[model samples]
Target: MLNMNRPNDVEAYIARAEADAVKIPGLENVRPRGIASAGVIGGGTMGRGIATALLCAEIPVTLIERDPATLERAIAEITSIIERNVTTRRMSADEAARAIKHLTTANEIEALEKSDLVIEAAYETMAVKQDIFSRLDRIARKGAILASNTSYLDVLEIASSTSRPQDVLGMHFFSPAHIMKLLEVVRTSATAPDALATAISVGLRIGKKPVVAGNAYGFIGNRMLAIRRHEAEAIILEGVTPDRVDQVVENFGFRMGPFRMGDLAGLDLGWTRDTSTGATVRERLCEAGRRGQKTGKGFFDYDDQRKPVVSPEAMDIIAGLAADKGIARREWSDDSILDRMVLPMIDEAAKILAEGIAARESDIDVVWLHGYNWPRHTGGPMHYARTLGLDTICARLKAMGRTPSDQLRKLLAAPQERQ
Candidate 1:
């Protein structure tokens, strides 16, 4: 029998050769661009950065906010960013001012009547998105493209809200959309070729590298992220310390380890949204009100420097939980922890491609490198997988008894570059 506990060293060579053939499929089948003016809704962090990027591209953008105070705050944030750019000699004072002038704000969505493109940077709730799209269908100009900066949520359902479903698409911009180059342009079956083309063009115009993805829940980046988080949490539940997990990854290449990332981004951010799913094991710590860095507690404690130091409180909690479960604390070897985490990611990537969600491995790699902050020099997750092999991915996954979880099992069952 094959060594299910480790990678298939023989197949790693074959996978590397296959990944080397990765390329961009031509958009020859799609309409390129017919619209010019752009508008963005919501004035949250993502909205502000997206608006700034659009204005920087000199495209007239109406930033829709719910209230005057929000508009003011967004304007202040945009101004602060521009001033910093000027200070760094990235842009002249005159150029910065010019870009700032192109931004217009409104307290209502109806103000976007003249926009050729309107992107909702609002809440990720399905109801809210459907309502917004319904309203936009009534207000937005005919042939105008409608886009969403949603990380997860179904684009097809949002498209269904409008009579012009063909024009609805996803333009998932990473946080601080102005800086991140990767953008996932999700296309539903009803989405028109022209709309997708325009989204890609606009992404490029705003200095983003847009990758076309199929309309799937969470799409490529977030889907991969879900699996990544699952693997991270699983290890912690076993025996590996957060610090140890971080050490193994950082030593391999990542700038920061998984726990540090969870702390900085807030441990409660995803869990709060996932409460009903029961897919996550959050109730234990969350019910105790130990949210994360904001509450000055999480996987680790922080001092004035805000550096992550292992929390005795957390260790106590882990111990109590383990004892309650009658589970012995097994010291996870460094290799076991690293193999379990990384191989699952590669397995997830194979599943991602097989589902036809991401058009190619490069797209998956691009999102990981630019958006999710996966170590860049390694050439993204897919590339990392190729470096390791298809058989190796399968071997490790089988060894760990991981099969994409219920959320992604179908993809693994598909015919693809997996052993």
Candidate 2:
């Protein structure tokens, strides 16, 4: 068994796991096609970041946006990003100029026809993505690899929109795609070997640590993240302060706690302005215009400097919601709070494993480690569970009124060597 307490040993384990993640088994002999030029659909934050990353890699990029104004803004934003790199000394002025020269913008899908690969970083809704893919199928040239940057929607369904399902796949990049290292290369059942290989190769070329995953909702990182977020929200409703919950997680080694993360990401990300019903805490917060840091308020209030402070208004909202739901306020110990926030994620990871959404245990670890900023010392959730002992984890879940997944149970029953 690996020594979890040794920092060097943990680091080495993570390195090996990451190295192993990119080596897809069946595609061992398949060569990756070169991605000389690329196209990115949508010019939003993610699309801009992706276009910037491709430009930095010296890959000619055509960024497509239907709105002329949005297209102009995207071009300006991309130029600003390159200029910022020069200001930060990350890129020389001359190099920045060269990178900017490679970016081209357009207001139609026809601009992507000759591109080697086209990644749709459009809106997250399935209908929007499917419509884009349907048009891409007609516009993109034969053998051009088509991909989606969808975080949760079904890649198979998106692929189904196209006649060339073999050319379709998911290249799920985390926020700030220009900087974050993790990339989930999701392959649908119909995805061609060469197409998958090409994505993995291009991901490495762009300085991303790519892990191949089966097509599934949320893929690996976000699939597991949904569980953690759900539990975090649940505990707050039960009377644990959001900051206290955050403190327990931060103390456990994460960079930030769930509520803080939600605030940073903005609570109104998918909430529509028209549907202003004061139902859930999030809806109530949105109804009040406490969208997030952008508006200087969210679950926590932000000062001019953007640091989070406890918001009495937010607290009242939570309390009122709890009372409305008839949930009694109860103080929870730090350990209980930690368990409530994290154990469910571990359980969901087990389900992901059992369902074969992740190729190996280490792949899941890689997803959490690089994508979610899982503490390096913990060796990701799956490894952390093993370090805690499968039997111990199962017992803890049982005590907390949760059932361990069948996969976890099986791992517990197996020989130590297998675990």
Candidate 3:
């Protein structure tokens, strides 16, 4: 059996990899035009956050919205954020005033014409993005870098709408874009080398820890996150309660477990009224109108103040789903639960490494450390896997009755390469 505990020398290894994680590839040759001005489309939370970061970096920004009402709301929300930061001494009053002065709001897409860099933080749908990029292609000046703040959509498809595909790339920012340190600078096959360099330059300017990822669904962080979430949902259907699953994960050093995160982000993220089958726990919860923290209930119910409490209603739903699937109900040990949740992510990372979707294993670690809040001391998933030993991880996967990917098999064959 594989040892479940981390090796004693894990910290020493972490120290070494952390130094290599932040280096951007092909940066020395990148002589991107200085981004003195920027434009942000769709003045929602993400747009506002991106705009704020630009303003704070002393780059003037043009924030565009659909109409007068939304433009007003976006401006108000942005001003309030700056005001609060000033009040808390996070930004000086003079600095806040200067940032506010640097901001410009517009109700027309044409306003972005003067921007040296244009980031479309509009809705996530492909059609909406396609329309925006198509228009930007015409409105944006020659040589201006066009970026999409898309989380999972194909950047290549989005780039196709525009004639200058080389100028296009994905600048994926996590939620609360201003505060989050992780930015995935996704490069498509057609992305210009200078464009990629420009993105790395701008991302660092805004105080973000940027990592380069290839053009793929979910890229590096989200692709592996999907794997973890799939297994987490599966084990739930096999008898684990949401709270118990969350507890084991939280005990592993994550601030919040999967279920709690789902609740906070809302169960309705991907749920649609047209797809109302109630097949999964999330779909059923949405069908029941438990839209999560916003609605006071989800996988866990909330008190009036919105603190999560284990809901008997949620347990009943889980039990019914388990029965429907013909899975026997049973208790799970913390160790078993932790392994099931984490090992799949590690396996997926190995596959990502083999596929060259990420530059280095440490880059994947940087994505998780800053993007997903993986425990920093563990040195991200790839480092954690190294501590477990590739051979040991391969054996554990087989013992868990899971099929290891070919990439995993190859890694096991040359385990010394991992070191």
RMSD to native, candidate 2: 1.9
lDDT of 3 by residue, 1-419 (tens): 22225454555554454455446566666687778899999888889889888887778999999778878988998888888888889889999999999999888889989789999998889999999999999989999999999989999999999999999999998878888888899999999988998898898898888889999889999999889888888888888888889999888878889988888888897679897887887888888888889899999999998888999888888788778879876777888888888988888887888888887777888898888888866767876776777677877788668987888667545642321
Give the Cα lDDT of each candidate.
Answer: 0.76, 0.89, 0.84
TM-score of each candidate structure, all chains considered together = 0.86, 0.95, 0.93
In terms of lDDT, model 3 sits at: 0.84
Identify the runs in model 3 with alpha carbons over 4 angstroms from their true place.
Answer: 1-25, 412-419
TM-score of 1: 0.86
Pick the TM-score winner. 2
> Candidate 1 residues 211-311, lDDT tens each?
78888878988887787778887777677777899999888778878777777776665466445443333445565666667777778888888888888
Residue 167, model 1, lDDT: 89
Q: Which of candidates 2 and 3 is the stronger one according to TM-score? A: 2
lDDT of 1 at 131: 94
Where in model 2 is the C-alpha error above 4 Å?
87-89, 273-279, 412-419
Question: Higher-lDDT candidate among 2 and 3?
Answer: 2
Clashing residue pairs in candidate 2 (N, C-alpha, C atoms within 3 angstroms): none
